[model samples]
Target: MKKLLLIGFMLFQYMSFAQEHAWVYLTDKENVATSIANPISILTQNAIERKATHSIPIDERDVPVNENYISQLKVQTGITVMAKSKWFNAVYVIGLETDNISVLADLDFVASIDFADKSLNSESRVALSNNKFEIEESLIDFEYGSALNQVEMIGVDHLHVSDYTGEGIVIAVLDAGFPNVNTMDAFQRLRDNDDLLGGYDFVDRNDDVFEFTGNEHGTRVLSDMAGFIQDEFVGTAPDASYYLFRTEDSAGEMPVEESYWVEAAERADSLGVHIINSSLGYRVFENENYSYTPSDMDGNTAFITKGANIANEKGILVVNSAGNSGGNEWQIVGAPADASGVFSIGAVDFEGNYAPFSSQGNASQPTQKPDVVARGAAAAVVNSSNVIINNSGTSFSSPIMAGAIASLWQALPDATNEEIKQFVRMSASQFNTPDFFLGFGIPNFELALEIGLSLAEEEFVRFKVFPNPVSNILNIQIPTSAEPTNLKIYNVLGKLVLEKNIIQSETKLDLSLMASGVYMMSFESNKGSKTFKLIKS
Candidate 1:
């Protein structure tokens, strides 16, 4: 009996030191009213301004997690507080999966507990997965050098020529590490301009993102956006400001990194970051118990995906890399990239052909997984040693696309996040017929700008059109005091299909004979000309 008792004691000790991870969700903040009333105390001035511009309300989620509850949890035996997320009203804790973590649920203030290890929990919970930082280095013009194809592919070169190079936009880069950005000559211009704002290392919980030399994935990723060498290499958004955060642990893959990522994202949102470019994708972890099934990639299942959607709700454009898992067993895009609000980017060759190595979208998803593609194969980027090199992956493609988006957003600063996404999607090569491989294919920023301008003009037009997808008849409502209006309809090929002149307040046009496709209608009068996009069904 004593031998059996000793064996039982040993097993208990083993379980105690397992060092399992879990999130302890709290019941309430207790200071929600006060924090919501004074958002400035919690959020930065820029963040408050962004919310006001987007009309997002300051709620309890904006309130910081109650420190008292955290302090209470810290005193518990065999438990260590790792990270706190106000957005989820929870704190990530590390302890024994059985006793220490489960005991937390007994506390009145503790609402529930979720274990990272799915089998450990009595209740069902999501198991997160993460991709290791990997890249395919391949061995890119004059002013743009080798970067010309990437820049011009998405029609951002025209915006650059017009001096709209992401001057006032702010982008946050969350990745593994930035080794030599502080000392690299390729980033000297960025430093001289003081556009490198700030950053944090959530893995080590420090601000020394460039202090480590273990992984340089982030260095290459940032080079696609902020790196500028006079007339040698230019990033997509050379003039944009940046905040670099190291959220991925280069030494290992763990679910804890997802919590770290959420912490970094919260900080980015507080700083009023306009865009988030995460070249890192998560789908599988070092521990098989935490691996995610393909069905879990439904945009809301993964923890990171949930946080990403919340980030979007806060009015930030989140861009992620569609994982490099193509032609493999797990071929679909990973979490956060699977998020509906995230602009997941895929890779394409210089010839506008889809890169087979780029991950594809799953048809079972609620929305398209990869919203667009950019040049990733043989893409030009600056390494940590200040050397311009070619790298291939959706990693490079995402930053390349993100930098261009910053420039596009700079041009239409008043446009909402949804509006910006709409314009870009509408300008893609395969907008009308997207496929699983390349989703919407590629976008043309030049055409996107034209679309935005045209829609802005339509807002002031005196005519109103209804039944946008009209089958047989189209109705146009003109002001009672309007002059004679001339209407012209054009097909997708820019060829005139129909034309008419109308003086009535309400005019109906017959279109039963028109082919079923997309068309544009233009109205001309003494005041000005207005254009409306129409779909003939």
Candidate 2:
């Protein structure tokens, strides 16, 4: 009996150390029905699971399986596998027979299945509590040519939609109470775009996804990123969709908050969400020893950090705030952003300068975080009165950037999340050189759109290439329908060195004599001048 208890304890410990949350991809390549039953229990030895897209959905509630119901499901749809405990209905069951996807899709009772992990891989950073402030003037809009911040907003009216927006993409934004979101006029565009989807509240552990309460900060963040665009402040992804999840309870910070985020992410994954955005992070608490040191930032110390990484592996894009209090003294950007796989966004002023309050990143930790910067400095967001208020924080910057990224994603649906991240990073204000303050700097969606690499369905200039990677000869393939065209080629440097004009069929350029380096070949046509990255080797 003692030996039995010891064995049970050992098994328990091992299970405890396993990944906090996980999901399996349901694919067409594998069958899910074969299971071996021992005298004690059903054992899964080897029947071929784990292939990409070879995943199955189970009830997250973990209610006792109705043998009758299971038999009926097998008869109705061909799903023969029973779910395992632990994850309940929250996780995708890996071995469901591949035949039920169509039938399951037809069932309105079934909500959604796992998409991909968009969680950030970074670990949580140590917290620095200083210089935190509230929104100013609630929410407001400046004149078309106002003395206010025009540097960042310059020419925003003509800014084209050409990047990923989570349009039709459902994201579960787990944070504190998003107070007064419905009352804000700035979020009206989200309503108009139908980007605002339904959500659940795990903070109160119920379903008041948009509760009206203290610290309207959370609501402002959501509005800046996913709120509909109006005459007030325009979010990055005005047309992208969202699922506002409330995981952070009001008033105080609790360790249980971490567990709540995990559950929320798991639910988000099950709901076929494309991304999960959490602006709330943890490091310190009223209980001082609960405070974390830099070493704990490996992503292993916190439950939420593990969930953050798991969400990424599943293919959902997770974006986190780098945190405030840069002016005082913080070690690096806080966790899950500090964890390895996530994108941490810092704040920069409208003048293209790093905000003094924005956090910094150390070269160490799970990863060098605060991967990029956005106009987090004194930016405009919608307030409770449906007014536009100017707010500032890495928080505000993150959502604004997220909105733009969502639009970019919308524009380029085919872009891998990592590719989208890289594209944004490469096209940032400071891609060539980065610093602790701004990282890769703010991204230029105009540039991203001009490249026309995104999956955007909108009409934009598309790059046409003929005989790509031409050795001695480069051809500018032209369509007869296109207007007259002008072409230019440049090395990595912005300096222009080659120019051409297309009169008829196609224009040819000689590159065999050119030095070896990545170059950009661009064409100015009727739609617009589009650019593409050229590889020489």
Model 1 lDDT-worst window of ten: 122-131
Candidate 1 pairs with clashing backbones: 140-146, 141-145
- State the displacement of the C-alpha of residue 186, model 1, in Å, after optimal TM-score superposition: 1.4
Candidate 1 yields a Cα-based lDDT of 0.84
lDDT of 2 by residue, 1-537 (tens): 999999998886554323122232221211123211120122111111211232322222212223443343345543423232122222232123333433454543333443111121233334335222323343345543221242143222234332234455556677777766655566666776666667777655566666674666678777766654333345555566777887776665544466567767766665566667777677664333234555566656555677787766555678888877576655567667776668788888777788887778776654545778877777776655655567777777777666666666666656555556666665677755667788777777666554546323233234456565566777666666357788777554333557777776566677887777556666667666565666564
Which residue runs does candidate 2 get wrong by more than 4 Å? Answer: 1-166, 192-194, 228-230, 451-537
lDDT of 1 by residue, 1-537 (tens): 999999998886566446678889999987789878888989999999988988888888888898999999999988989888889999999884458888998899999898877777643434343444457774422334868889989999999998989999999999999998999998898898899998999888888999774789999999999988887789999999999999988877767788888888899889989999999877766655665777888998878999998998898999999988876777898888999889899999999998988888997776876889999888899988778889989999999989999999999888767667767776789875788788888999998888777865635457788787899988888886359888878654334679888889898888999999767677888877776677899
Measured with C-alpha atoms, the lDDT of residue 24 in candidate 1 is 90
Per-residue error (Å), model 2, residue 512: 26
